[model samples]
Target: MKRVAILVETALASGRNILAGISQYIREHDDWSVFHPTGYMGATDIAGLVDWDGDGIIARISDPAILKNLKAKNTHIVDVLGNVQKSPFPLVKCDDRKIGRMVAEHFIGNGHRHFAFLGFSSERWSFERQEAFGQSLEKEHGQVSLCHLNPRHQGPAHWHRNLDHVASWVEGLPKPCAMLVASDQFGPLAMKACERSGISIPEEISIVGVDNDQSFCELCRPQLSSIEPNHTRVGYEAARLLDALITDERTSETLLETPPLSLYTRGSSDTMAVSDPALVKAMRFIRQEACNGISVDHVAESAGVSRSVLQRRFKDQLGRTVGDIILSVKLRRARDMLAFTKISIPEIAERSGFNYQEYLNYIFKKHLSTTPVRFREEAGR
Candidate 1:
């Protein structure tokens, strides 16, 4: 049997998901003797890792101590945690840049004209994510306000300081802005800051985070929306690469980036950044009920307004009529399904509230200037 050490933490969903993937690989191979610790990587575990003469190691390497210990190991090593930009070992981690771009597209699609990115300054992955997010958002929005919450002392005082700083930073930004936090761990911190600042979420501010840590996301007043990085795939790829290196099977020492799975929408970011409450209500109603072949009248009734009033509001606020908004929403849904799924064109039309495939083609040509198939092909690249 091959001895392998897993130095990833067990406290977070990301780490656990990586472990789950490793477990799956080991079960299939039945040759790995894993040396994973019981909880978070501590001093004792680090010592144990130093003592163990494993054939290979897969580690987050967030702590310098872990890196130092790992460097001393004369074995094949895979670093899953992307804390360093250039490292001695091959990296198997999430595509943080793509994650940022995805979240930026999400917020931009939801009509956010202003954006902010919050993250830790010490982490290379966090910085990379923030850079990609700012660049993507700034192309259309002109400028993205950036903030970094660096590591500080462990206490309630520092926590309160962070809250105050975030509250101040957010309060100064333009209203109806979307905030893309670096991770779910900071989601609640931002939410708490908003609570302190009395800024309503998804109205004055919409927040999206990375790593779909459900427990942290759900614990917030309005649940957080996050990008689900495929850590399981990362771990599997890591194991495959490590096995190749262990057996001297000609493995390349380079970084492998696993693309994110999907964005999990939640209460925190499931709204447009519009100021009009009536328009917001109408839009939400249409989004939830549009697939049922709802019309402008249905939208008006849902928002408790006359058709004419709703139309005027839509024109004034969004420069689009009620019918136009409904169609655009339908088109967006259809486009997302096309890019992400293998559903047929006819079924996609039916699901996206288009009555016929011919109509979907016509709309795509008119509004999107491309056929559904072509769009899917382009999106795949």
Candidate 2:
């Protein structure tokens, strides 16, 4: 029997999802006793890990002393938390660089010329995301305004002051700007900043954050758009690495970055940065009702414009017709569900406003260059 210490915290959805992946690994194997720490555990607590005697251990930790102790104990370790820059254990983490580039391309595709990034100066992960975002924009001959806060100083006074600085940054940003936050936790903070400046979202400023923390994303005033990192794949791959180490079949791989699932759009970034009232209204209408089988005529009527006018305006401003925008919205919804949920293809088709499963397949192939099932497979891994 292989006694394994699974010292992963379950406080956030990401952590819990990692545990789910580990659980999957255990189910496929035999005689593996899993010991997982539950509830709250303090950082830098050696006892939380040292008390357990296991043949192999998989933990998301950062304290150097703890790492030294684990190394002395000679148990296999796989570090999922990449916050520690140089740990002896192998690492399995999300690709923050890819996530950053993905968000940049999203904003650029939506016709956003002005951009900004919200993050913590204290965190290495945040810095990495910010750098990647900047590089991607530079490739497109664009740049971003940066507002990074350091949360090392704890207190209400410090938090409020940070919020104020964020507000000041927002107030100074160019109009019709698109902002990318390092994580979903800070999405609402930026939104609050916007509120302080009396700025409207998806009109003056559109926000997209990384790490699609559902609670943070949904609870925001306009709901947040965020990049969904594949937490399950991180855990699953970490467990696999640990298993390999346990079996004395360790390869040269020391760090493996799991790819992001997809960017889920919500009210925060559902519209383009355009000033045409009719075009904006048409976009708003299409985003809301596109999955309800609405057509270009319906979108035109909702915008109080004729179909010809709406299509012409869409091409002028968004470089696409009304039908393209409608199809894009529907595809985004379908893609989100495919990557994040277990909804069936037929059900996804109906919910995405497709008349039949075959039509959904046709659209997926014609647009995404792959079938829905294949997309799900790639996203899941």
Candidate 3:
């Protein structure tokens, strides 16, 4: 049996999912035995485990000195997180750049030109997303205002402690701004600050985040819209690449990219491109009831407008028909259910207000450019 060493950091769901996938693979494979030198080792302690002679090392950290030591021994390293630098070993990374572009597009589509980025202090992924965001916005000749929240300053105390500082930043920002956070952890804090400051979500301010940690997203009031990084797929791919390296079937310096993340647009990022109050309310009602067998008539009645009037207003305000909007919301909700729940496809279809799976498929392909299972797989990861 081949022995493998695991070194990782704590407090991030991405890291946890990677480790879970690796452990599951180890248990199912007979030829592999694991040696965990320590649980969730930090960057400074990696050198002590360097001489273990394990077949490979899988971790989410990317320190230059640590990589130097590991490479000196010809150890195989897989970068599950997007922090590694140029290395001889294979690397697997989430497409943080694409995620940034997608979220920026979503915000811009909703007619938000004033932008802000709630970023972590010193992470490579943070920088990558921030760069992609700026590049994407520049295409429209627009600018993104940025804010960096130092987690250390927030301290380990109640996250609420940071609300005052965060609120001050929001008050200074221009209205109708779209913000993207570094991760799910910081996204909620930002939302809390917004709530405390009387800044309404998807109205006064719309926010997006990376790493769709559902528990955290749902836990926030109004729910959070986030970009789901395919962490599990990254983990699986890294393990397979590490296996290939350990078996001597592949050489060093291999690089692999996971598929782009499929975004989950919830209440937080739900808004129209137009500034019409009636149309915005109609859009919100459609979003809220879309997964419950909603129809054009239902939406029209709920919005207290005639079907013809609703259709005209929707097309004029949202650049789409009422039917199109309903289908879009239903399809998106179906995707969310498919991703976070173990429900069957047919059941998901019914619950998401679609009468048939084929209808679901048609709409999903039309908007998201992917199938339901593929979306779920990417989101689950």
Report, for all candidates in order, the number of backbone clashes.
Answer: 1, 0, 2
TM-score of each: 0.74, 0.74, 0.72
Question: Which 10-residue span in candidate 1 carries the lowest summed lDDT?
Answer: 37-46
CA shift of 108, model 3, Å: 2.8
Candidate 3 residues 62-168, lDDT tens each? 56766777666567677666565665556787888888889888987888878898886477888889989889998774677777866457645745557777888
Task: Order candidates by TM-score, high to low.
Answer: 1, 2, 3
Per-residue lDDT tens digits of candidate 1, residues 172-284?
A: 98878899999898898999988888777766789999888977887875678899999999889899888888888986658899999999987688766787777767876
The number of the candidate with the highest lDDT is 1
TM-score quality measure for candidate 2:
0.74
* Model 2 CA RMSD to the hidden true structure, in angstroms: 5.5
lDDT of each: 0.83, 0.83, 0.75
- For candidate 1, list the clashing residue pairs, or say none: 202-205
All candidates in order of lDDT, best leading: 1, 2, 3
Give residue 79's lDDT in candidate 2 (0 to 100): 85
| lDDT tens per residue, model 2, 1-381 | 888887777756677778888888888886688876565532334466657788888777655666777677688888887776678788898888999999998988888888899987666678888999889988665778999887564345677887898999999998788999998878888999999898778767899988788888878867799999888889889888888888899499899998899998887997778977777677767767899988888998988988888888888887888888889889888887787689998999999898678999999999989999999999982
Least accurate stretch of 10 residues (summed lDDT) in model 2? 37-46
Q: Ten residues in a row with the worst lDDT in model 3? A: 36-45
Superior by TM-score: candidate 1 or candidate 3: 1
